[model samples]
Target: MTELGRFGVWVPHTEVTPAQAREIEELGYGALWLGASPGADLPGVAELLDATETLTVATSIVNVWATPAKQVAESFHRLESRYPGRFLLGIGAGHPEITSEYRKPYDVLVEYLDELDAAGVPRERRALAALGPRVLKLAAERTAGPLPYLVTPDHTREARPLIGPNALLAVEHKVVLDADPVRARQTARPRVEFYLDLTNYVTTLRRLGFADADLAKPGSDRLYDGLVAHGSAESVVKQLVRHIDAGADHVALQILDDDSLSTLRALAPLLREIP
Candidate 1:
């Protein structure tokens, strides 16, 4: 919790049981990030914190549409009171296609942060789910740094500057531990295709070196490979280091293959020696 040892896991609220949460903590991960589409319940941050003593429980984002700012603030206060300094609130500007009332996303998030601040949610405890410069900049100035999703090391490089040096610029990167380039790409492409259709993600990827064709259906091999980390254990470790070298304070690793327990166990011997 010293703003270091920052590797973490991105999990759905329900996918993680208390037992799994305990295992992740024992694995040496510093935080557990929760992500869900719109209307997904928060899985109760208190439960995650209660289940584990040291590991941080973060929401990759709780959609602003389904959950109101005031309610989120209340939850923040309640959880922080029970377990001080162990919860990080991450909120986002959800996709335009998903919500008809999703107008003025930038303004909405700015206003939301304003409300959160007014409600006494300190800057340190909250973060924005930003994938663009304007929002990323706001994240730096308003609260914690940007939590940019589905990004590459190149994107991490671009975002670090936007968030500046002091803010926590946490980014999520996907990985598939398959040596065959085609097999790895195949495993990772579906994971990225749906995100590509969203203009926010599309633009961010283009910034990181993806082309129009690359963003097409199934995603071009170039886009797929660049966006997702794939290959042997050595190559995967290098890719993670690439993000940290590029300027990430922490990199949340979501290994794309099944057997998450085994992949996580495999990383222990490696992460322990990384520093």
Candidate 2:
């Protein structure tokens, strides 16, 4: 009733199973957010939903290039009717360089929302995969909230106001269980580097107090530490709490470890301490 405490895990579409999803639920994370990078998210979501009893599944993003909003809205409505509140359609205007169809992002998203509206996609049932300010504001106005990727508490603080009080704000952060600082940062660097190349993330990270120097290739160690939680479970807990205190309604974790279940298990004791 209180929105299941607002913690979730992000997984690649094919990697999750009902059994593993049960573990996530058992570990106290409320929702299971599926990354729609290279697959059909709706069908993948069906698999994830079928795997767990009450774990809500949202697309970390359903790419605008791959799926049309009207069709997605129709499909979303069908799923909402079938599953009720257990599904959240988080759609995004992905990068321009990655897709030939990319245009003005805000314009595209605005049009997409308009299409969804015509198709009867209720605003409250969806969220936006947003990072930039204009999109974040639009997301606040049009959907449930903003799901910001690779953001820190500072970005959350800035976004909290843009979204006002009623809209939900979920910021995603990376995490690793290794204790050695160097090893921890190293594990996070490779993944973080790619996002650094993407302007939206770089802009958000810059707004969050990171310098361009810190956002450079391989990512500065300090920047990596700020962006991703590493080392002891206690340390990771503190990072997540920072987000919660910074006006975030939810913090979706993208665990850097290979064994996601084991990572959850490691964080279980600390996760309970989040609120």
Candidate 3:
């Protein structure tokens, strides 16, 4: 129900600064999603919120396994009370490989949501990092909607109907700002390779029809191109727009370059006309 403007920035929590947060808002992006499952206490969140007047600051995901739902709920209320309607909570069931307590992801996520509900975290103020249909549907029913990561436009098309018409289908797409295909893919490979070993992502990619060859170590060129947008800023924007055309209510663009601020500035004007 919260209107995240057409485009937003997705950056690692460790990389964001107050000045960068302010500049991102001035550049006209709607929200800033802090990635890497930030702590339940949400250190530095208020500073970013304080630095901008209207920009929304969201967690790309707060790991339920690592952070208690009640603690997260309390933090949500604290931020909301200070900066009303400007913070969105995005949470997920993290990978089992890394989480010793990971078990029954769907059921765990359901229990987490129940805790949030008990703690009085408003449904509209939160979202899920949902990839599968079951969790996607739960996102639609219990929260704002899905903030899916590493998705193609085709995935967006399929996800829209599953979440139905009204829930927010905010998708995160990675972008590389190089024109040379070789260099772009080279820059994109490591990130792609990391996710390839993650069970949730691999399972979702398989469900999306990628072959084992495509999901192999280093990944296929087709897989890299499909997952990360590269080339000129204009060209990359075109690929990102496909997600919108496929029914995404919002697109959170994650820069794959070292100079993320520069990339965000370069893409700002083009992003304004995305919808």
Candidate 4:
């Protein structure tokens, strides 16, 4: 299995360019996680891979309902042949609202994995956007491990035991590099609001012990503080470290902002120094 260094950046493929991708590599981020849904062919993944050497590029997830497994596997093979160890395929069963045919997600994901296996996409070369015990176990048994999104260090602590000692637990965390508590929450709330509308996220948050009020629209401040690390770069690094201490093999940092490059560049120095 390819080691996805300790820290990575999660950004939308549409928002990042080849030049920017190269800069991110230079900035020392281990991997670049591209966010995509259905109909995403992942041409940008190839473009980013071509622009940099050594940095691993992974799809945060390719929605199973949006793209056929055969097509995704074909793309994975083509990219793997060209880039070799620099590409990791991250796939997931998206939300019920977004996927009209969303039902029996676990079974569907297993079928997709079967297709990838048939197409020769090695289990070690891929990861799953998994939450909950069943899916997390499946990720460990089938792929690299779960790449859980919008989770706290506590969740990481709980999840590590479920996936066991071998599987890679790459957790995604959102951060805001602002010192002011109000401004930080202001920046973080919008993203939380968006996820609050998604039932899957709400369910996961609830499982993490957040109250119903915390999962409410706009989300409670306590929930925001738990989910997003806001304040100085050092403080944010501390939050990332907590996840690592909780058994996370890698942490994908998602900056809440329109211009992610600036935030990434700003946080790079501090993140690179994380042991």
Clashes of 1: 0
* Candidate 1: C-alpha lDDT: 0.80
Error of 1 at 21 (Å): 0.9
User: In terms of TM-score, how similar is model 1 to the real structure?
Assistant: 0.95
Which segments of model 1 are wrong by more than 4 Å?
Answer: 1-4, 37-41
- TM-score of predicted structure 2: 0.94
Q: Best candidate, TM-score-wise?
A: 3
Local distance difference test, each candidate: 0.80, 0.81, 0.93, 0.88
Candidate 2 lDDT tens digits, 78-186: 7777777888878888777688877788888888889888988778878898887888999999999898988878889889998899899988889998899998887
lDDT of 1 at 147: 86
Residue runs of model 2 more than 4 Å from their true location after superposition: 1-4, 38-41
Deviation of model 2 at 262, angstroms: 0.7
Candidate 4: worst 10 consecutive residues by lDDT?
36-45
**Candidate with the larger lDDT of 1 and 3:** 3
Q: TM-scores for all candidates?
A: 0.95, 0.94, 0.98, 0.97
Residue-wise C-alpha lDDT for candidate 3, range 64-94, written one tens digit per residue? 9999999999999999899999999999998
Q: Which of candidates 1 and 2 is the stronger one according to lDDT? A: 2
* Backbone clashes in model 2, listed as residue pairs: none
By the TM-score metric, which is better: model 1 or model 4? 4
Model 1 lDDT tens row, 1-275: 22426588887666677778888999898888887742333556677788998988888888887788888888888888898988888899889978888888998898888889899989888888988889989988988778888888888888888788888888888888888999888787667778877888887778777788888887888777777777887788888878888888888877677777788787766776666
lDDT of 4 by residue, 1-275 (tens): 87689999887777788898899899989998888562446767888999999999998889888888888888888888999999998999989988776799999999999999998999999999988989999999999999999999998999999999999999999988889978889988877788898988899999999999998888888998999988887888998899999999999988886677888888888888878
For candidate 2, what is the total of clashing residue pairs? 0
lDDT value, residue 129 of candidate 2: 89
